[model samples]
Target: MTPPLAVDIDGTLTRQDKSIDPRVFDVLRAWADEAPVIIATGKAFPYPVGLCEFLGIPLRAIAENGGVVYVEEAGEVVYNGDPDAAWAVAEAFEQEGYDLGWGPADMVNRWRETEVAVSLDRPGDRLRELAAREGQEVVDTGYAYHVKSPSVNKGTGLVSAADGLGLDPEEFVAVGDSENDAEVFTVAGESFAVANADEHARAAADHVLDASFADGFLAVAESFGIATQ
Candidate 1:
């Protein structure tokens, strides 16, 4: 069997408008027929789940950067860190005059069970310092910052998801477009980065595609000879 393909959702699968291009969904549906397409994303748990449901695909998801994992039939499992601690850190940051903006009212927030995701204008280094002092981690998703336990990350979540599916971590392929995806590149047997990916992501990936977003993902599938139709 072909190894599962682990993909980041935000910038890797969505277009500039932050919407899933229909073509991308088409490719994903095709890829799903060949192998599991596990979504490893920094978004909240429900976001990816909703997307999969809308696409009518039963893919697994790693949400909150790696704090939570959800299998199609197995429900959600907390993979790392304490949600209380993460929320406390977010509160502390808020009290310190750092504007920690929760996502839209409909989406997940610090009150969620796995991670505290907040939008901030503060410097990334400062956030890192605060997180480190609290034994937590700060992940910059380019669109938002996430606070979670230091032990959890995209790589860890992917491993757990793969194992749950009876797949080996070494048999998975990871693809993403940001620094948070660095650990995933290290853990997967092979990794790819879109052309628009950050320097850190590009350096970590085994191959960098000339395309961006869903097109980049399709390029990867074609290279691996994974049928898209």
Candidate 2:
């Protein structure tokens, strides 16, 4: 059977410059034809939902790095972890005289409902401390550091999505390129990391691809005999 595919966005589906690779549209759409193509990422809610809409795939996503799971087919929008963790972190940053590193009118976390994403350019150690104080953990997703509850992650989101789809989370194949995707690697039946994957993601992946970014994802699809072309 064609197993479900759970994929990350920023470093998995995007190019090196962080732009969403249009080349992946057909490949992911093909995977969706066989089974669900789950867009799992640290990105905000609308990002993946918009991708699904354009890719013509099921509007299923594990957003906020696992803090939120949206299964459109099941009409289920599940919110996990500490709902106020993001806000708490924001408040803490204010107390610490930090600007969240985002300029005024930050749009990054504007639509975020659960977790907080800190710019990688900021002070990671300090943000981690604040997150820990808020009963949250900081996950490095290559592009940014996510401040979120430790309990909810891509792994748990996959389980919830599977339950809604009547599939098994362990039967799914996960692919990503950063630390936030580690738990998903553990939960999936098989895990893959792109050539550009970070140490945490590479260590967690069952297969490390030769290609990077969208090319790596195409390699994964081809490995499963799901031809993208």
lDDT of 1 at 148: 84
Query: Which residue runs of candidate 1 sit more than 4 Å off their true CA positions?
Result: 73-76, 102-111, 226-229
In candidate 2, how many Å is residue 136 off?
1.1
Pairing residues by index, what is the TM-score of model 2?
Answer: 0.96
TM-scores, each model vs. reference = 0.90, 0.96
lDDT of 2 by residue, 19-74 (tens): 98887888888889988889998888999999999888889999998888988778
Model 2 backbone overlap count: 0
Worst 10 residues of 1 by lDDT: 102-111
What are the RMSDs of all candidates, in order?
Answer: 2.2, 1.2
Q: Which stretches of candidate 2 lie over 4 Å from their true place?
A: none
Q: Mark the 10 consecutive residues where model 2 has the least summed lDDT.
A: 94-103
lDDT of 2 at 207: 94
